[model samples]
Target chain A: MNCRQARDLMSAYLDAALSPSLRQDFEEHLQECPACTAELGSLAEVVSLVRSLPEKPVPDGFHQLVMTAVAAAHPAPRAAKVPLWARFDFSRFGRVAWAAAALVIFFGLGLAAGRYLFPASAGSTAYVPPSVTAKPASYDATVATGGNTVTDTVAGIGRQVAYSAKMDLQVQDVRAAAAAVSSLAEQNGGYVEESKITTGWFGRVSAHVKLRVPQAKFQATVDQVGAQGKVISKEITAEDITASYVDVTSKLIALQTQEQQLLDLLRQTTSVDDIVKIQKELEDVRAQIEAIKAAIQNYDSLVAYSAVEVNLSRPLFPWLSVVWPGLGGP
Target chain B: MGPQSPENREALLVQRCQSGDLEAFGELIAPYEKKVYNLAYRMSRDAEEAKDLAQEAFVKAYLALPGFRGEASFATWLFRIVANVCTDALRKRRQQEVVSLGRQVETSDGEVMLELPDAGAGPSDVLEDLERQHAVERAVRSLPAEFRLVVVLRDIHGYSYEEIASIAGVNIGTVKSRLNRARQRLRELLQDGELFEPHNVYKTRAPSKGGAGR
Candidate 1:
């Protein structure tokens, strides 16, 4: 075995990637040639040093940048799930491009915001615009989960009752379910008052959606949403404000009657003192009537729509969102 | 319980990504993101270009995912894309510049014969392993692209010869020959540095016809 042959076998020999007989011949050549053996050592040293080179981390937020570039290039995976972005076919909108437009709008907000912003386009159409919704509003317990209230079964059969519910749900994917819940709200002639996915301490992520579906479909919406994930717990409460409503109405009538009487008394009074006293009493009575009217109106809307606060959470795994790659849905 | 093993999860992610689940693609390649970026860095010395090339490789993988018929492991397939992307990019960059394949340095004036590091510094501080590794990196980076590919893939990245062949789209013999030659070139470059004066230097002078001054 010559020095030339020994040099050829050096790397494979270092890797132990050589045939046994061939390795023996190379080893024999190395034993005879100090120059070739030293050559082999230096080659191994170079290989080792290259192997030990420090790794460079991709720049911070690099993952997000890559995702943004990808989203910009392709239609977001969820764009198909959102019918409006499809119908608008923002494809014609050119640069508005794909579902990734949402990412650009809410960059760093994560997929939860993506799901939220998508269905919100639908919510605006179906949701009760605050302008058109009755004024002097206080009570709209969009929380009622369609469960027949105790008022429905009791002696107050035609009762004006406000139903509100709270539900805890566990889902595999919070953002997807939140989107589905928002869509369901729109389908049921309701609006998502609040849909947010937040990352909490220890990198835990959970979503909460507030839906205001019509009382008629309140139960149906709850059932549909519960079907998306395991229902951790549910609580429904009904406030039969029928008595308060009726009492307020009767007081309103009495106050109006007092105001009319004061008006007539003012017409009869000849002295300025008598007229001034009656005018002040009439104003006070009119204010009472207006207050009662506003209370009754609030009761009417609250009774018509139930409020359901759907608290959707995912099972906490130490390795979930922070570690799992694709869970950051499209 | 960890219901799905890593392999099973990756297979499912690849399928989902193929069907246009961007999230699945992200998950599928999460482990390889840094690896691919480093692979790009190995191909091109420019950090920014490496980042762009790495990102481009992923986007290309995503677009072509539906056709990824599981012939190679997703990693092998993905890495091959990175190599092709980086090599093509490096080739373009190389062409636009005055191609220098010898001990040469760029200056405002033009190409200058490479300056050897101060041999007095020596390799006495092996604990300065980062410095030592970086020195080796300079040697590796100076190698010809063809040689650099197999060397980086095999030595630095620790890919088996068969995998290197598959990734480089070459047969095993080509991989071995290139890797061996690449290493020889690397040793010559290293020996030309800190420790000694051209201990194993081969007379490598790029033909003067291409770059007149060099």
Candidate 2:
């Protein structure tokens, strides 16, 4: 080490922080260079003198002063025996009877008030409970363009429903009917989820096609598929999933908030153990966030695609096939 | 619990403090009051402010007790809070006190007089040791808070570089560089204030703004 290098390493040298080779070089330089050696000596003296400085006694009543501030801030500690009292005090038959009666009376009064205040909440049933006032915020608040599902209708909120339809129809030719249904679904921005066709010995055919269309075109697609053959039976159902969707979405937002809070807590600690503990909690929060995200994505997918099942069959009798058009056949 | 170990006792005290027991909180902070006060004094440079900052540190510690899982010893955790509460309190004020750094002292006379005490000159001719110590304390307090922290922790408190790094939330390399720069600045201050026996025999020019020292 040269004089400049020695000066840089001198502090670490006195602290015994230098590597063996560097220490050797440092000593070699110091032996030849008096100026650097003297400078190092001065630095050492400063360190030692400061270390020798007497510790100032805390001012009188310092502890009392701090404790008073602390007490003012943290006022009360419930006796640790409270839990024990809770466990044992209810064991007496008379006390338990009184407690049960009081609970019933309190609940009855609360119900009466609740009924008076939110009369419509009970009878005008919605998918989400009226009591759950915390609105389910959008998963991604930036893009909320889909006019109606849970993702689009949050906070200002409306029900999120998934619609599906099943139809059994009679057609002159089941194979041709299935292809027409597939084309119709595709034209409506959807796909044929599943399609099956079978031929009987006498050329009678039956086909089943499951079509998935975007929710916006759900009713229109259903009407078109019904027209593919004479509709023998048609069933359409809407499943309200607002409660489950809202529940999952709320959990997601909460977990994200906790993740941020954990990150802030991690910054306040320099202890390796504290960092590790907080990181573990952060990891768990991250995992839960991802899981909730996936669940919301699944909800979005179900709401986006409305399922339509079309079953088409050629009549067993050739004469019945003749009147297939506009005929509700067996 | 017949004569519990210090760690066990501290753990109990912390547990009770977390449980909202004010008395336990008081006991927990009593032993650290002197050390905490001195550090607070170092950062604030005013006795009244130091007292307030020390109390604030304890109050903050009390509020944060639930999160203290004994990862670091109670003393380490508490002193970290002392450093934080005091430094944060001073940060805004420090930003406004833009005194010239060691790098900025205009030594126009070209007399590079560093107050590094010569080996031959003992403490006899200069001020009394106590007076010199007070000067050192003033010089230390004058150092900008960041540099002052490493100096106080390393030189005054005898904390290891690693401990300083942990408390200051900086790496060890930062701790080393900060100590070197702070001590260099302090040497200049002591010499400029005539608090040390200047190595007069072979004095060079004043340290060029920033270039002469590390």
Candidate 2 residue runs with Cα over 4 Å from true position: A75-330, B1-3, B97-127, B198-214
- Candidate 1 residue A134 Cα shift, in angstroms, is 24
TM-score of 1: 0.48
* Candidate 2 local lDDT, A6-82, one digit each (tens): 88887888889888999999999999999998888887877776777677778654665566467557644344455
DockQ for all candidate structures vs. native: 0.39, 0.43
Residue pairs in candidate 2 whose N, alpha carbon or C atoms collide under 3 angstroms:
B112-B205, B112-B206
Q: Which ten residues in a row have the lowest lDDT in candidate 2 chain A?
A: A125-134
Give the Cα-based TM-score of candidate 2 against the true structure.
Answer: 0.47
* Positional deviation of residue B79's Cα in model 2 after best superposition, in angstroms: 1.2
Candidate 1 per-residue lDDT, tens place, B1-214, comes to 2649887788889888877776677788889998998998998876767878888998888888889988999899998988889778876776687644444654333523343353223234563445556667666666666778898898778999999998999998888778887787677666766443422221232244346765
Predicted complex 2: DockQ? 0.43
Candidate 1 deviant stretches above 4 angstroms: A75-330, B1-3, B99-131, B196-214
